[model samples]
Each structure stands twice: as structure tokens, then as C-alpha cells.
Target: MLTTLSRIVKSGWLNFWRNRWLSSSAISIMGLTIFVTTSLLLINVLTNSLVQILRDKIDISVYFNLETTEEQILETRKSLIDLEEVESVEYVSQEEALEKFEEKHQDNQLLMQSIQELDDNPLEASLNIKAGTASQYEQIVDFLNGSQYKEIIDKINYRQNQAVIARLSSITAVLQRSGVVVSIILALMAVLITFNTIRLAIYSSREEINVMKLVGAGHWHIRGPFIVEGAFYGLVAAVIVLIIFYPVLWLLSPKMTAFLPGSDLFYFFRINFWQILLLQIAVGVSLGVASSLVAIRRYLRD
Candidate 1:
């Protein structure tokens, strides 16, 4: 069994190396496919990061009435925290709010003097509510409005931020759907291309295959070499693509980071090195092996 397997591998390696131009053509196409698919995956990650940054910036601030006690506000905050949709709720006392306001307008002398003249803190204590997703904010606002403690709430700012949150929600939904559709279409195209390439290689070796069949070579003996050749193509292609990605990402990372702050392409690549490597290998090998199987099955049928 070991001897037969070694011969199969040797034959496959020779088959790959013997047809240099054809093998190169196959490898190039496979590499391009892997590169594009991997790129799309990175883009999806970057987009999600940007969306999270925006989501972080957006939250509904619920202000309490002056008569509302700290204990009451704490209870309301606890209730908000219990909601499944709520990611977090932060409580800011009136004094903290006043301090933030003053710091924000400190450069303006008139505003500073006006705020200091007030005998009591005009700023209200508030609960800053962050939801799991932009769409969930509306539900949270609804919950707050209908809660038994609603009378103590001075205002919920969701109405003012509704348009922005709605737009973000729409964008997120569209991106997710579009990413899946694009990924499927690209994968199908890659498989077809690889299958055709393998079929061509088989065609070039038709006479050899016929001679082997005439000698009563078993199906495994006949098919094993081609499968090995296909897997070799995938391995080489994955290596070439990974090498190409290093310089490309290094060059693009700074620019991408500049455009989208925290979305550093190279940094992401480095952090996810093993995952990306495995993913590319998995995709490439699966495409190559599956395509080879289908292509050879057709020839065998004939």
C-alpha cells in the first residue's frame, strides 16, 4: 500500500512538472481566485469594524427629571441592563454632566461665565444606553417610554437620532446580504474555472490514460494521480497567494487605516495570520480536489 501511494504521488508530481505551461496556467487562475476571495473576506471584516466604530459613537441618552433620585435612576439603569437588546447602560450624575458640558465649552468665556452663574446644576443626570445593534435601539426606546418609571424620565433622545440609526441599520443589512451573494457567485466561478483547467490537463494525458485502462489498471490507480496533481496545484497556488498578499497588504494598510481610522489592513493580516493561511489553503484545496473529482468522473464515464 505504501509503495503504491508513493508511486501515485511520484506520478502526480511528474505529471504536474512535465506540463509546465499548463500547470502554470492552472496555478495562476487558482491563485487569482484565492486572492480575490481572501480580499473580500478582509473587506468584510474592515467594514464590520467601521460599522462597530460608528455604532459606538451612536447611543440614546436618557435624561432624568430633576426630582428623580439617584436610587430611582439606578433602578432604571438596572432595568435597561436586563434587556436583551441593550449592550450597556452608563449612569452619569448631574454633576458629571455639568463638568462635561463646562469642559466642552471652556474655551468660550461667555458660555463659561453663564454656566458658573447658575446656582443649581441645570444639566440632568442621564443613562447612556448602547444597544447591540442600531435597529435594536428603537425597541429599547419603546421599552423605556412604556416602563413604569417613564414619568421620572425627562427625555429619550432616540427620536432625534432615529434617521441616522435607521440609515446605518439599512447599510448593515445590505452589506451582509451582498457579501454572501458575491461570495457564492465568485466561488462557483472559481470551481468552474478550476474544473475546466483540470479537464484540459486530463485531455492532454488521454493517450496515457487509455493505455493504463487497456492494461486493466484499477479506477483508484487511474484516478489517484490526478487527484494528487490537483492538490499540488492548490498547495502551490496558496503559497504564491500568501506571498503576494504580504507586500500588497503592507502597502495598503496605511492608506486603509487613514481612510477608516481603526481598519488597519496589515495589522488585521498579521493578527489573523494563521486563520488566513488555513482558510486560503482550505478553500484552494477544496476547490482543486472537488473540481478534479468532477472532471475526472466525466472522463471516466466516457
Candidate 2:
């Protein structure tokens, strides 16, 4: 068994080396396909990160009446935290709110003077409620509108930001679906191109194949080399992609960081280097082997 496997591998390598030019095109295309696949994976990661950042920014700010007490606000926060849809409920005291307002308007002298002139803090205590998902915001707002808390509650800001949240949800869904679809389409194109290249290889080696069949060689013995050749294409392409990715990501990292401030593409690549390499190799080799198997089917039937 081991000898047969070695022979198949050796023959596959010979075939690959013999038709290096043909293999070159296949490898190039396979590399491009893998590159695109990696790009899409990274893009999806970035999209999810951006989405989470947006989600973190958004939350239901329930401002309480100026007369509302700390105890009442704490009770309301506890109630909100108990709800299944609510992820968290953070209570902001009036003093904290006043401090934040002043810090935000410190550059504005008129606003600074107006705040100093006030006898007491006019800022209201508020509860910032974050939900598990965008759709849950409405339910949370409804919960806050309950009669028990209605008198002390000044207003819920969810309604004001409802449209923006809804749009964000829609956009996220669309982007995820679109990424999957585009990946599949590109993969299929890679397979088809590799299949055709392998078919041409089989055609070029037809005379040798016939001689092997005349000697009563088994079907797998005949097909194994082609399969190995396909895998070689994938393997080489994966390596090329891995090498190309390093420089590309290194260059883009600083630029992307400049544009998005906190985004570090190079750092992300470095952290996931091994995982990315494995994924690229797996995808490249699978596409190659699958394409070769399908391509040689017609010839093998004889």
C-alpha cells in the first residue's frame, strides 16, 4: 500500500513538473482565488468588528425626572437587568452627568459660565440600557413605559434613534449574506478553471494512460496521479497566497489604521497567521483535488 502511494505521489510530481507551464496558470488562478477568499474572510471580520462598535455606541438612554431619587433609579436599573432581552443597565448619577456635560463643553466659555451660574445641577440621572439585539430595543422601551415607572421617567431616547438602528440591522444582514454568496461564486469559478486544466493534462497523457490500461492497471492506480497533481496545484497556490498576504497586510495595516483610527489590519493578520495559512491550504487543496477528480471521470470510465 505504501509503495503504491509513493508511486502515485512520484508520478503526480513528475506530471506536474513536466507540464509546469500549464500548472503555472492553474496555480496563479488558484492563488488569486485563495487570496480573494482570505480577503473576504478578513472583510467579514472587519465588518463584524465595525458592527459591534456601532452597537456599543447605540443604547436606550432613559433619562429620569429631576426629582427622581437614587434609590428609585437603582430599582429601575435592577428591573431592567432582570429582563431577558436586556444585556446590561448602567446607572449614571446626576453629578456624573453634570461632570460629563461640563467636560464636553469646556472649550465653550459661554456654556461654561452658564453652568457655573446655575445654583444646582440641572442634569438628570439616567439609565443606559443595552439590549442583546436591535429588535429588542422596542421591548425594553415598552418596559420602561410601564405605569409603575412612568411618573419618574422623563423620556426614552429609543424612538428618536429607532430609524438609524433599523437601518444598521438591515445593512448588516445584507452584508453577511452578500459575502457568503460572493465567496461561493468565486470558489465555483476556481473549481471550473482547475478542472479544465486537469482535463487538458489528461488529454496530453492519453497515450501513456492507454499503455497502463493495456497492462491491466487498476482504476485508482491510473487516477491517483492526476488527483495528486491537482493537490500540488492547491498546495503551491496556498503557499504563494500566504507569502503575498504578509507584505500586503503589512502595507495596508498602517493605512487602514489611519483611516479607521483603532483598526489594525497587520496586527490582526499576525495574530491569526497560522489559522489563516491552514485555511488557505485547506481551501486551495480541496478545490484542486475535487476539480481533478471530476475532470478525469470521463477518461477513467474507459
Candidate 3:
């Protein structure tokens, strides 16, 4: 068995080296396909991360009437927190709000003068409500509006920002659907390309294959070399892709960070290296092996 395996490996390597250009052509195609798939996967991951960041930033600020007591606000917070979708609720007193505004506009002398001229903190105490998902924000807002303390609840700022949130949600939905459709189409195209490449390679060796069949060689003996050849192509393409992608990402990381401040593109890619590697290898190997197997099956059955 070992001897037969060694012979198959040797033959596959010899054939690959002898027809270097053809083999390289197939590998190049596989490499490009893998690169596109990997890029899409990376984009999807980044989009999800960005969407989560946006969702986290989407909060409903429930302003309390100036006369509303701290105890009443605390009770309202507790009630909001009891909702299963509620991730967190924070209370910001009027004084704290004023301080925050002042800190934010410290450079604006005109704004500073206006704030200083106020007899007292005109801002109302508010609760910042966060939900687990963007879709849940409306439900929380509805609950707040229907609550007994609704009178003391000066306003729910959710309505003010509804249009922006709705647009973001729509965009995210379209992105997810488009990602799935594109991935499927790309995967099918890759499979077809690989299959055709394997068929061409097998056609070139048709005479030799027929001669072996006539000599009464076992099925495994006939199939082994082709399988190994396919695997070799897959491995070679995967290695090429990894080599190219690593440096490309490294070069682009800084630019990505610059475009999206606080983005962890470099760190995210580094952390997901193993997953990406495995995915690339899987796609490469599956394409190569499945294509070879299908291409050879018809000849073998004959």
C-alpha cells in the first residue's frame, strides 16, 4: 500500500512538473477564486462588527420632567431593566447632562457663554436605554410610552432618531441578503471552473488512462494519481493565496484603520487567521478533489 501510494505521489508530481504551465494556470484560477471568497468573508465579518457598533450607539434617551424625583427615575430604570431585551439603562441627572454638554463644546466660546448664562441647569434628567438588538429598540420605546410613569417621562428621543435607525436596519438587511447570493454564485462559478480545468487535464492523459485500463490495473491504481494531482493543485493554490493575502492585508490595515477610526481590522484579521486559513484550504481542496473525482468517474465506468 505504501509503495503504491509513493508511486502515485511521484507520478502526480512528475505530471505536474512536466506540464507546469497548465498546472500553474489551474492553480492561478483557484488562487484568484479563493482570494475573492476570502475577501468577501472578511467584508461580511467587518460589516457585522460595524453593525453591532452602530446598534450599541443607538440608544433611547428618556428625559424625565424637571420635577420628577430621583427615586421615580430609579424606579423607571428598574422597570426598563426588567425587559428581556434591555441590555442596560443608565440615568443621567440634569447636572451631569450639562457637564457632558460643556465638556463636548469646551472649544466653542459662544456655546460656553450661553451655558454660563443659564440661571440653573435647564436640562432634564434622562435614562439612556440600550437594547440587545436594533430591532428591539422600538419595543422598548413602546413599553416606556405605555408605562404609568409616562407622564413624568418628558420625552422618548427614539422618535427623533427613528428614520436614521430604520435606514441603517434596511441597509444591513440588504447587505446580508446580497452577501448570501453573491457567495453562492461565486462558489458555483469556482466549482465549474475547477471541474473544467480537471477535465482538460484528464483529457490530455486519456490515452495513458485507457492503456492502463486495458492492462487490467485496479481502480485505485488508476484513480490515485489523479486524486493526488488534484490535491497538489489545491495545496499549491492555498499556499499562494496565503502568501499574497498576508502581505496585502498588512499593507491595507493602516489605511482601513484611518478610514474607520477605532476599527480593529489588523487585530480582527490576526485573530481570525486560523479560521480564514481553514476556509481557504477547505475551498481549495474540495474544488480540486470534487472536480477530479467527477471528471474521472465517467472514464472509469467505461
Candidate 4:
């Protein structure tokens, strides 16, 4: 088994380097496929991150009545937290809410003067509720309405902002689905291109392959080398992708962060480095080996 494996691998390696121009052309095509695939993956990642940042910013702010006690708000928070669909329920004291509102309007001299004249905080204490999904906001609102603390509740913005939330959620869903469709179509195109390339390579070797069969070489003995060659194309492409991915990200990230502060794409890439590498390798290797096998079999049949 070891001897046969070594021979197969050796033949594959030789085929790759011996036909240096052909090998380079094959690798270049394979690299294009990898480049497209990786580009799609990165776009998806950035889209998801941006959408999530937007969604997290938009949440249900449940306000308590002016007379509502701190204890009552804390109690409501506990109830919100117990729900399975709730991601988080953050409590903001009335004073803190007032401070935030003022800070936002501080640059408006008229607004600052008006607030100073009021001599009292008009903002109510609140629980900012985020659910596992936008669809679950209604359930959270219902829970708040039915809770024992409902009497102290002032208002929940879920009703007023529902339309905006629904529209954003729909947009996000459409984008995600579109990305998957595009990725799949490109992947199929890549596979076909690779299959045709390997098929041509096999056709070029048909004369040698026929002589081997007459000398009593088995099907696998002829087939194995081509498969290995395909895999090597994938391996080299994957390596090239890795070589270029990080530096490209390093260059692009600062620009992206400048466009969207706290997007932190560089940190995100580092955090998910292993996952990204594995995904690219899986795509490259699978495309390369599968296309090669299919091409060689078709060639043998012909």
C-alpha cells in the first residue's frame, strides 16, 4: 500500500512540475476560482457583521412610568431575561437616560437651555430589550403587557418602530440568500472550468495511457496520478490564497474601519482565521480532486 501510494504521489508531482507551462496555467485557473470563492466569503462575513451591528443598535426600549420604582424596573428586567428568545435586557436608570438624551443634544444650545430650564428629568428609566431575532420582539412586548408589573409600564417602542424593524430584517434576509445563491453559481462554474482543464490534460496523455493498458496497467494505476495532480492544483491555490488573504485584509481593514467605525474587520479576520482557512481549503481541495477524478474517468471511457 505504501509503495503504491508513493508511486502515485511521485507520478502526480512529476506531472505537475514536468509540464511546467501547463501546470502553471492550470494553477492560475485554479487560483482564479479560489480568489472568487474567498472574495464571496469575505463579503458575506462583512455583510453579516454590518447587519448585526445595525440590528443590535435597534432594540425594544421599554420605558417605566415616571412614578415607577427602581425595584419595579429591576423586577421587570428579571422577567425579560427569563424569556428564551430574549438575548439581553439592559437596565438604564432614569438619571442615566436623562444624561444620554442631554449628551446627544448638548451641541444644540436651544435644547440644552430648554433642558436646564425644566429643572427636572423628563426621561423615564428603561429596559433595552434585544431578542434572538427581530420576529421575537412582539413576543417580548406581549410578555411585558401580561406581566404583573404592567401597571408601572409607561410605553414600549416596539409598536412604533415595528415597521422599520421588519423592513431592515427583510433586507438582511434577502441579502444573505442572494449571497448564497451567487456563491453556489460561482462554485459550479469553477468546478466546470477545472473539470474541462483536467480533461484536456488527460486527453493529451491518451497515447501513453493506451500503451500502459496494453502493458497490463490497472485502471487505478493510470487514474491515480491525474487525481493527485488535481489535488496539487488545489493545494497550491489554497496556499496562494492564504499567502495573499491576510495582507489584503490588512490593507483593506483600516479603510473599512474609517468608513464604519468599530467595524473592526481586521480583528474579526484574526478571530476567525482558522475557520476561514479551513473553509478555503475544503473548497479548493474538493473542487480540484473531484473535477480531476471526473475528467480522468470520462477520458478513460472515451
Candidate 5:
């Protein structure tokens, strides 16, 4: 079995190098396919990360009446945390809220003057609620409104922030869906190109193939070399892409971080290195082997 396998591999290598131009063309196309596939996967990961970041950053602030005390707010915060959908609830006292507002507006002379003229801290004591998902915010608001302490809750800022949340969720959802569709279309085109390239390469060797068949060579023996060649194309392409991909990732990490404040593309890439390599191999080998098999089957049918 080992000897047969070795012969098959040797024959595949010879077949690959014999038609240098055709094999090179196939390898190049397969390389591009792997490249595109890997890039799309990264974009998909980043899209998910961006969506999650936006969700994590956006939360609803529940402002209370002036009469509401810090203890009451803290009590409400405790209840909010007990809810399954609530990821966290932060209580901000009126004094602290006012300080934050003043600090934020310190650069504006008019706003600072207006704030300074106030007899007391005008900001309301509040609880900021962060839910597990975009869809759960409404449920949290409903809970706050109907709770035993509802009378103390002056307002939940859901109305003011709902549009922004919905818009961000919608955009991210659209981006994720569109990315999948585009990736599929591009991958199909790549596969089609591969299939056709191998088919044409096989067509040129039809006479040799027919002569071999006349010698009563079994189907496996006849088809083994082409299959091996196809796998080789995928294998080599994957290696070439990895060599190019890692360095490119290292170079782009800093720039990506600057463009996106919370993103660490390099870290993600590094952590997922083995997964990425395996994915490349799976895609490359599948594309190559499938294309070769289909092409050979067609030629055999004649």
C-alpha cells in the first residue's frame, strides 16, 4: 500500500511539473481563492466583534425624580441585576452624575457658567442598565416600569436611545448577511475557475488517458494521479497564502487598531492561527479535490 501510494504521489508530482504552465495557472487561481476565503473569514470575525462592541457600549440610563435617594437607586440596581437578561446595572448618584456632566462641559464656557449658577446638583440619580442583547432592552424597561419601585423611576431613556440602537443593530445585521452572500458568490466563481482549468488541462491529455485505459488499468490507478495533483494544488496554495498572510497581519495590526479604537485584529489573528490554517486547508483541498474529481469523471464518461 505504501509503495502504491508513493508511486501515486510521484506520478502526481510529474504530472504537475510536466504541464508547468497549466499547473502554475491552477496553483495561482487556487492561491487567490484561499486568499479571498481567508480574508472574508477575517472580515466576518471583525464584523461580529464590531457588532458586539457596539452592543456592549450602548446602554440605557434610568433617571429618577429629584426626591429619589441613592439608597433607593442602589436597591433598584440590585433588583435589576437579578433579572436574567440584565448583564449589569450601574447606579450613579445625582452628585456624581452632575460632576460628570460638568467635567464633560468644562470646555464650553456658557454651559459651565449655567451649571455653576445652579443652587444644587440638577442631574438625577440613575441606574444604567446593560442587557445581554439589543432585543432585551425593552424587556428591562418594562420591568423597571412595573417594579415595586416604579413610582421613584422618573424616566427610562429608552425612547431617546432606541433609534440609535436599532439602527446600529440593523446595519450590523445587514453587513453580516451581505458579507456571507458576497463570500459565497466569490467562492463559487473560484471553484468554477478551478474546475474549468483542470478540465482543460485534462482535455489536452485525452489521448494519453485513452491509451492507458486500453491497457486495462483500474479506475483508481487511472484517476489517482489527477486527484493527487489537485490536492497538491490546494496544499501548495495554502502554504503560499500562510507565508504571505501572517506577515501582512503583523504589518496591519497597528493600523487596524488606530482605525478602530477597541479592535485588536492582530491578537485575534494570532489566537486563531491554527483554526485559520485548518480552514484554509479544508477549503483549498476541498476545492481542488472536488474540481479534479468532477473533471476526470466527465472525461471518463467519453
Candidate 6:
């Protein structure tokens, strides 16, 4: 078995080397396909991370009337925290809100003058409520409005920002749907390209294959070399893709971070290095093997 395996490997390598242009052509196609698929996967992951970050930044601040006591607000906070969808609820006192406003506007002389003209701090104490998802924000708002503490609540600021949240929700939905459709199409294209490339390679060796069969060569003996050849193409393509992708990501990481503040593309790439490597290898090997199996099946039956 070992001797037969060695011969098959040698024959596959010899065939690949002998037909340099054909092998290179197949490898190039595989490389391009893998590159596109890898890039899409990376983009999808990064987009998801960014969306979560944005969602985290978004929350509904419920301001209470000046007459509302700290104890009443704390009770309201406790109620909000009890909700299943609520991730967190924070109570901001009137004094804390005033301090925050002063800190924010200290650099602006005009804003500072306007604040000084007021007799007292006009800001209200509030509870900032965050939900696990955008969809849950509405439920949080509903809970706040219907609760016994609703009379003390002056305003829910989420209504003011509803338009922005709606737009983001629509955009995320479209992106998710589009990603699935595009991925499916790309996968189909990759499979077809691989199948055709393997078929062409096999056609070139049709006479040799026929001679082997005439000599009563076993199916495994006839199929093993082709499988190995396909795998070789896949492995080479995967390597080429990684070689190109790593540097390309390195070059673009800074630019990507500029557009997406706090996002470190290079860091994310590094973190997912092994997964990406495995994906490339899987794509290459699967394409190569499946294509070869498909092309050889008809001949084997004959």
C-alpha cells in the first residue's frame, strides 16, 4: 500500500510539473476564488463587531421631573434591571448631569456664558437603559411607559433618536441578507470553475487513463493520482491566497481603522489567523477533490 501511494504521489507530481501552464491556470482560479471568499468572511465578521459596538453606544435615557426623588429614580432603575431584555440600567443624578454638562462645555466660552446666565442647572436626573438588541429597545420603552413609575418619568429620549435607530436596523438587515446571497453565488461559481478545470485536466490524460483501464488497473489505482493532483492544486492555491492576503490586510488595516474608530483590522486578522487558514485549506481541498471525483465518476463506471 505504501509503495502504491508513493507511486501515485510521484505520478501526480510529475503530471502537474509536466503541464505547468494548465496547473498554474487551475491554481490561479482557485486562488482568486479563495481570496474573494476569505475577504467576504472577514468583512462580515468586522461588520458584525462594529454593529454591536454601535448598538452598545445606543440607549434610552429616561429623564425624571425635578420633583422626583433619588429614591423614586433608584426604584425605577431596579425595575428596569429586572426586565429580561435589559442589559443594564444606570441612574444619573441631577448633580452628576450638571457636572457632565459643565465638563463638556468648559472649552466653549459661549456655552459657558449661557450656562452661567441660568439661575440653576436645568438638566434633569435620568436613568439610562440599554437593551441587548435594537428590537428590544421598543419593548424597554413600552415597559417604561406602562410602569407605575411612568408618572414620574418626564421623557424617554429614545423617541427622539428613533429615526436613526430605524435606519441602522434596516441597513443591518439588508447587509445580512446580501451577505448570504453573495456567499451562495460565490460558492457555486467556485465549484463550477473547479469542476471544469479538473475535467479539462482529465481530458488531456484520457488516452493514458484508457490504457490503464485496459490493463485491468484497479479503480483506486486509476483514481488516486487524480485525487492527489486535485489536492495539490488546492493546497498550492490556498498558500498563494494566504501569501497575498496577509500583506494586503496589513497594508489596509490602518485605512480601515480610520473609517471605523476603535476597530483594529490587523488585530482581528491576527486573532482569526488559524480560522482563516483552515477556511482557505478547506475551500481549496474540497473544491479540488469534489471536482476530481465528479469528473472521474463517469469514466470509472465505463
TM-score per candidate: 0.96, 0.92, 0.90, 0.87, 0.87, 0.91
lDDT of 4: 0.83
Name the regions of candidate 2 deviating beyond 4 angstroms: none
CA lDDT of every candidate = 0.87, 0.85, 0.85, 0.83, 0.85, 0.86
Q: How far is candidate 4 from the true structure (C-alpha RMSD, Å)?
A: 2.7
| Top-lDDT candidate index | 1
In model 3, the runs with Cα more than 4 Å from the true position are 105-120
Once fitted onto the true fold, the runs of candidate 6 whose alpha carbons sit more than 4 angstroms away are 107-121
Instruction: Name model 5 segments beyond 4 Å from true.
Output: 69-71, 106-121
RMSD (Cα, Å) for all candidates, in order, is 1.3, 2.0, 2.2, 2.7, 2.6, 2.1
- Please, what are the lDDT tens digits per residue for candidate 6 over residues 85-195? 999988899999989999998999998899889997788999888888777888889888888998998999998989877777667667777887888898778778778
Give one clash count per candidate, in the order shown. Answer: 0, 0, 0, 0, 0, 0
lDDT of 1 by residue, 194-269 (tens): 7788788878877777788889888778888988888888889999999999999999899888898878889889
Candidate 4 residue 292 Cα shift, in angstroms, is: 2.0
Worst 10 residues of 2 by lDDT: 190-199
lDDT at position 293, candidate 6:
84
Higher TM-score: candidate 1 or 2? 1
| Candidate 4 per-residue lDDT over residues 1-302, each given as its tens digit | 89998999999899988988888777778887888888887778777877787778779898899999999889888877989989998899989998899889989999889888996788899999998877788888888899787899988998899998888777777877888899899977876787788778778888888887789888888888888888888888878887888898899999998876668677877998888778777777777788877777755663
**Model 5 C-alpha lDDT versus the unseen true structure:** 0.85
- Looking at model 4, report the run of 10 residues with the lowest lDDT sum: 293-302
